[model samples]
Target chain A: MTSSFTRLLVMVQKELLELVRSLKLLWVPLVFVLLGVMQPASMYYMPLILEKAGNITEGAVIEIPQPLGSEVLAQTLQQFGTLGLLVLVLVGMSSVSGERNSGAASLILVKPIAVFSFTASKWTALLLLAWGSLSAGYLASWYYTGLLFGDVQASKVLGSLLVFGLWLSFAMTLTLFFSTLLRSSAAAAFSTLGTAAALSLLAGLLPKKLGWLPGSLSSFAYQTAVSDIANVSLFGWALACTFTLMAAALTGASWLLRRSSAID
Target chain B: MYDNFDFGQILPIIAPILTIQLVLVIIALVMCIKAEQTRGPKWMWVLIILFVNLIGPITFFIFGRRNER
Candidate 1:
């Protein structure tokens, strides 16, 4: 047991080192930070932008009200949900298939490490990147929102960050699962993204029945950010579902990779 | 229109975005030049890394590299 744990650790370190060497560790967070920053900055300048673009009468005035701090932060969360999610999925799309294509997976599978540990290590490394990038981007956005739009409660920010990070983890686990299942990285990325979008859409379309789905975590996160009172029970259920889904995806990936490594 | 738009406040707010973009461009360019095999011609990637703003570097990172593990 101890040896397996150590193997997992070593694999995690290797995965993280690859991330660092590829410059993903640097650029992904920067891109997310840019996404985060754009929200409040663009919202702050919306009136000016409208004034510059819109053809108005001489005496017309732009009466758009400034967004509240919480709203700006929520907008940042939405940005993270879309473009940030895309960046993360793209970054991790090649984690398994790329190694397989390069014959690295075959070489690594010959070692004493268990396939579960191998997949777990990849999940761990990607989770670290996802959570780290999310925190950096959210905090930077929080700072800018505070700077430009006043301050949101720290508790709200922390709560929403945790909830949103779970949503991202759910999406990333799906990416890893697809990466292991499919040979083509583009197909893996597309399927993972399509699944996530469809799930979110379904949850949106039927909120009452599908409230416990992992996709609801995004809405729970938004509520945690902007609303004073959130549905605690719903959030708990969504959290539990997301955790289950992530665990299932990881196990499935490990199983698939274990069976297919020899073929690859 | 003679207006009271202060560039000073906006400068501090917007500078980081510009700086991050510049840094990404530079880093992507350097990596492209150093990489032994990229998906396309080196000169094309150099042009993309130089011309496109935020997306150029990211595209190069994702699709441009060959045999990245």
Candidate 2:
């Protein structure tokens, strides 16, 4: 008997191709890299540009916080984080719903391909894309920051990046779940944004004591990673919440497929 | 030592990693086409092989290899 599961491997290969070939594939990472580059590049040069402007409205000597030391980092993360998350959102939107729209799912199902493979491939593809793009962004951002600040604390940048990665996983999961629920790309994309936004607001309405909820943990990471906020238990809860959300999302997708299969 | 990233130096590493993916893509296409085994138009198979290279090949092997149900 063959030891390796050629089936699983092949399925993964298909997913990577789908992602790599799409025009959006190029655009998604391009925009993300732009976000990474633009943030630090723009911020580092901003003061010089402003100084050259010669104070046209010379009424007040306004002191804008120069992006030095931790400040460079603050600006970088804030700009990149927001843009990167949007990229993640668009990626999650495309993952399943795009497959649905393209009739790839229907075409593949008629063959021997298992539905589980369908689900797994999508998750793997998005995760890998996230990995590649995030790593690239981090490296670029680090270099840019080093140019301004002597050198940033690697531990701090790594810690904050890890936390951001975790939060992004949740956002992707929520988007994936919505995509599976609604086969339309527009519906999947908007529902994901609306759902995340709503849940965050809703989490705020609840007591600060319940900080481990998915919504709360997502926000907590920014302060904890960048600003030295503490609560080991919150991080623990954050991990737990992320796993639960992912499990729930995958479970929901699986259940949806099974039911649809049955109905057909 | 950690700050040793020369933009020129990094390009070589990034290049091979990316090129490796292309090789993998071609290998995947071959596998998908072979497993499919039919002599008819392979446009659908080609798309699956070319488009969704990672998952597409596997999907083709598991789902697309056999005649459609």
Candidate 3:
């Protein structure tokens, strides 16, 4: 058991090194920070931007009520839900399948490392990146929101971050699972994004019925930020479902990878 | 519209966005220069990373590299 733990640690280290070498560790979080900052900044400056770009007649009033700080932060999460999710999926889509397709997996699998360790390590590294980027972005958004608008409660910000981070973990885990199952990275990315879109769409369409779905985590995060969550039971269910799905996906990826490694 | 707005107030707010963008572009350029195998022509990626605003560097980071080695 100690040896296995050490192996897992080694695998995680290798994954982190690769991420750094590829500059993903630097760029992904930076992108998130940019996305986070842009939301509140643009919203704060909307009037000025519109005045400059729209070329309205002088003295033409464009009186738009300022959004609450929490609402602005919620909007930032919305941006993260869409474009931020896409970037993460794209970055992680090639985690396993790319190595396999390029024959790197065969090289590594011929050694003594366990396949479960390999998959678990990849999952861990991806989680680190996802959580790190999400936190940086969320914190930036919170700071900017406070600066530009008004103070949001620390509990609300932290609560929303945890909820949204779980949703992102679900997305990243799905990408990893698909990457292990499929040979093509593009297919893995497309399928993962498609599934996320469908899940969110379904939850949005039938919030009363599908509130427990993992897709509703984004909504939960947004609502938690803007005000008190409307349904505590539903949020709890969604949290449970997200954790279950993430674990299931990781396990599925490990099994698939073990089979594939054996075949190779 | 132009006279009433305080440049001092606005610059501080927008400065971080521009700084982050500049950092992204610089990092992308450095990586592009150092990368041995890009998905397409290196010169074209340089163009994209330089000209495409916020998305260009992200695009290069995601799709431009072959991800080998």
Find the candidate with the highest lDDT and give its number: 3
Which should have the higher TM-score, number 2 or number 3?
A: 3
lDDT per residue as tens, model 3, A1-264? 999999999999999998898888999999999999999999998987898898799879988999999999999999999999999999999999888877888898889999889898989999999999999999999999999899999999999999999999999999999999988899999999999999999899999999999999999999989998999999888888888988898888888888777554
- lDDT string, candidate 1, B2-69, tens digits: 16777896899899989989988989999999999999799999999999878899999888999855
What 10-residue stretch in candidate 2 chain A is worst by lDDT? Answer: A22-31
How would you encode candidate 1's per-residue C-alpha lDDT over A1-264 as one tens digit per residue?
Answer: 888888889999998998898888999999889999989999988877777776887778767877889989988999999999998999899889989999999999998889998899889889999999999999999999999899999999998999899999999999999999999999999999999999898888888788888988888888889985356777678778888888889999999998889986
Off by over 4 Å in 2: A1-5, A23-26, A51-56, A202-207, A224-229, A261-264, B1-69
Q: Can you write out model 2's per-residue Cα lDDT over A1-264, one digit (the tens) per residue?
A: 232356657888987886665433554454455455556666654654565565657554546675554555555556554657665776577566566666666677677766767777777777777766776766666776676555767777777677766666777777777888886777888898887676667666862666677766545545643567577777677679778888888888867865664332
lDDT of 3: 0.92
Q: Global lDDT of each model? A: 0.90, 0.63, 0.92
The backbone clash count of each candidate, in order, is: 0, 30, 0
How large is the C-alpha RMSD of every model relative to the true structure? 1.5, 10.1, 1.4
Rank the candidate models, highest DockQ first. 3, 1, 2
Alpha-carbon deviation at A239 in model 2, angstroms: 1.3
